[model samples]
Target: MLIETTAWGKLEIDEDQIYHFSKGIPGFEDVTEFALIELEKSSFAQLQSTQHESISFLLTDPFNFYHEYEFDLPDTDAEELDIKDAVSVRSIVTIKEQLELSTINLLAPIILNPLNRKGKQVVLHKSSYLTKHPLWAGNSILDKGGE
Candidate 1:
């Protein structure tokens, strides 16, 4: 299927690459369907909304930057996504003017059930993580923006 995007322009996507966010991402509750496209030669992937061409987010495996990153999937959320065995977790990447200063959201990671293509951005209420954490230089929060 072909979908229009603001970043990558019009591209063909496979059905398997699509994920359904029943309650939608935090701020984007209206948009539910998104295509997870992993960029070539990169550790990041784009969660592009299929319904809204302009709505897109860059995602990355939190573990890639934070080896110690850990979070327990609430039983409620796991059951909602129908996550049985196959699960995927990703963090939303926030790009900054200074490329090195970019951050990824650790407080709420995007969780996915690859087996059923269900997804959600589950917020960790018990974690010490913040909404913005440096994508590199460990998992410490260093945003001067005071987020």
Candidate 2:
């Protein structure tokens, strides 16, 4: 299947690579189908909408930045996506003037059950995490290659 993406142009992806999000991402409730495009040599991946060319999100493993980052995955929400145990957790990233100034959205992480190809963005109601937590202590995104 071919999908038009804003960042990657025309992309050919397998049918199984498409993810169905019953509740879509926050603020994007209309788009529920997305394809995860792996970025070159980087932990970041493009969560591109297969329906809209402009609807795409840059996602990354939050643990790459905040190792201690942990949150609750309510059983109720997990059951909705049919998530039993294993999960693919990723956080949305907001790039600033420079890559070194980027911030990760640890407050709400996207959790996906690959076995079912279903996902949901769970927002932490009361938590210390932030939507724009600095990528690291200081200038580490470029200094350490975001490792």
lDDT of 2 at 31: 96
Best prediction by TM-score: 1
TM-score of each candidate structure, all chains considered together: 0.94, 0.90
Full-model lDDT, candidate 1: 0.92
lDDT accuracy of residue 2 in candidate 1: 97
Tens-digit lDDT track for model 1 on 1-147? Answer: 999999889989999999999999988999999999999999999999999999999999999988999989999999999988999999999998877778889999999999999999999997999887887784344635545
Q: List residue ranges in candidate 2 displaced over 4 A.
A: 139-147
- The positional error of residue 116 in candidate 2, measured at the CA in angstroms, is 0.6
Which pairs in model 1 have colliding backbones?
A: none
User: Model 2: how far is 3 from its true place, Å?
Assistant: 0.4
Error of 1 at 85 (Å): 0.9
Q: Name the candidate that leads on lDDT.
A: 1
